[model samples]
Target: MQQPPSHAREILRLAVPAFGALIAEPLFLLADSAIVGHLGVAQLAGVGLASAVLHTAVGLMVFLAYSTTPAVARAMGHGQLGKALAAGRDGVWLALLLGIVLAVAGFWAAEPLVALMGAEGDVRSFAVDYLRWSMPGLVAMLLIFAGTGVLRGLQDTRTPLLVATAGFALNVVPNLWLVYGLGWSVAGSAAGTSVAQWAMASVYLVMVQRNAARHGISLWPDWSGIRAMTRVGSWLMLRTLSLRIAILATVFVVTGQGAVNLAAHQLAMTIFSFLAFALDALAIAAQALIGKELGASNSVRARQLTGTMIRWGAGFGVVTGTLLAVAAPWAGALFTSDAGVQSVLTYALWILAAGQPIAGYVFVLDGVLIGAGDAKYLALAGVANLAAYVPMLVAVA
Candidate 1:
């Protein structure tokens, strides 16, 4: 039997790199917010609304990565590398297919969607441009999600860390040049990000292809496998949608509070999101490790791993919460110069920090259940959770 400390070490090994990869997504958004913010309040608000909608849409599809990761890891644990690679290939095909459907729909619906969200005047115009230009990026984003799953399942978190780091680094120059030098404004932010997403997707596709060939797995779509994944993913999608609904509900309430409150909420949400990725790194590690253990029929070991991971999650939450509390004052200044917005943000940050422990536990358990192939239960629980959350939000509002 492995020592308890060994489990901690294993979790850290996977988590450290997963942290880098996961954090990149939010960091990119933070960059967009910071840069677009300089254009004025309306531009910043437009980008925020567009981004919120985009996140909700793509967020539901994240099951592509979550479902694929555990399935591939399980297959690998059974010593079926070829089978695992084939399963992963099906996920990639599904991602590509779904991405195209979403892109078309999103482009067509951009203006109406922005209107539906209650934007008007310059805010509406800027949001329409940002939302439409961002659709192509969705395709690449979905592909990357599926590809990351394959790599993570193959027990190679380092690849995603390296790719995401490079992608983020490359994103900065183009974004600055297009937004400032070329004067594309909000549209430039979307275009620069779209280019980076596609580059990352291309690299992942090549890597996946090479690995498939090495394992003698066919690159062709496996309809049966894809169907199975979709069935599982549908439930996961519901789970994700439930969470997004909660977010949108919160945003809706905040928006009613006035412009300063809305701006503060966006800033606070961005920071909370970035911090979440840190906590989520441990959850990602749990998915890969727990799935592999369960696949090997080591239920006892799987239980042990889950227990250890939960503790790690709690520890991380404590550290993050402390840091967030300490940095709240300075952090607000980094994102904006508005004193009113800064004051509102400072208040929100404290509330977020207070939820860290619960958030950590919930996130880790969510990942563990997914690894155990309990997507249906997770989906049902998501609805119940949302039901509970709405009333609280309403009361607060």
Candidate 2:
């Protein structure tokens, strides 16, 4: 057998830290779900709907990280430190501007959005309250996303790992205090999360500022640079939005099935998302390494890195999938005791496990292409994928 690549160590260094950072947010949400679950099914359902909306909104702006990583990595790879820092700063500006717009829109549109999701009665009311209260946090989330991008581009995943770890640790105390100690219910969970998010964003801003000062880069926005970032970001946004639509469509279909189905789906999804952390970390490493190599005009090394990542991703997926399959018997017990929910979740876990290897390949390929700056093709592919998935969903429904 061929020996493993000598650079496997570098990939692990990046992937491990990136994985920690990636899992932080989901872990926070999982904590919230666990706490709110005891309050009753309606509240849990409410939190699920609100979370779906918040996730979709934030997911659409993930380009803040995705676009900045490649742009900054490419610039830095070419030894243009100043330009790299400048590009990162532009991403921050764009993130702030877009965050404000999205916060306001999502807040005001919360009720109708929930209604459109087929939520009703107490579920709708609770979802609206949670979503509206969480809007400010979305701003913090967007800022953190962009700042994390800047740090990743400079080849420093450790900082994000530290910050995310600290932030997530801080989240649990407030969540418990507000949700149980103070009796705020689902709204309290939202409040605690919002506070934690802003705290994380504040820390990230300080770090970014110090880095900028160290490099003698201006903190002020550059319209031209911002526009350039947006040019790439727009395509990413489209691709991201298309993915969200696919998820939203799935949620809609599940909702029509009834509250029990939706809740079970939510639990299964949470598990799937947690597993994605590993794949995502590898993908992130691929993005940074591939972008850096391509930026240095080392196409051959970039290809080699891509190949290595795909292999690792597949191997990791198989391992994770096996674990998921073994744990499937006990996975449902952790989320809920409801017979109906548990029944559905058992099968869902197996399905999710079986698909893990395919997911791993797709995730790795996606990051490689994104790092190659093939945003337009990715956008078109997302649309096509959605077009295909929708009909299948309809058929199943």
lDDT of 1: 0.88
lDDT winner:
1
TM of each candidate vs. truth:
0.97, 0.97
For every candidate, C-alpha RMSD to the true structure in Å: 1.5, 1.3
TM-score of 2: 0.97
Residue range 1-397, candidate 2, lDDT tens digits: 3435566877888889999999988888888877777777678778888888888999999999999998888988899999988888888888899999999999889999999999888888888988998998999999999999988888889989998898888888998898899998888889898898999999888988888899899999999998988888899899999988998888889878887788778877777778887689988888898889999999988887788889888988898999999998887677677778778878989999999998888888888888899989999999999999998999988
Write candidate 1's Cα lDDT for 1-397 as tens digits. Answer: 4447878788888889999999988988888888887777678777877888899988999998999999998997898898889988999999999999999999999999888877778877988999998999999999999999999888789999999999998888899999999999999999999999999999999999999998788999989999999998888999999999999888777766666777777788888889998789988998899899988999988999898888878877888888888888777777777888789889899989888987888889988998898989999998999999999999988
User: What lDDT score is found at residue 271 in candidate 2?
Assistant: 78
For model 2, where is the 10-residue window of minimal lDDT? Answer: 1-10
- Per-candidate clashes come to 0, 0
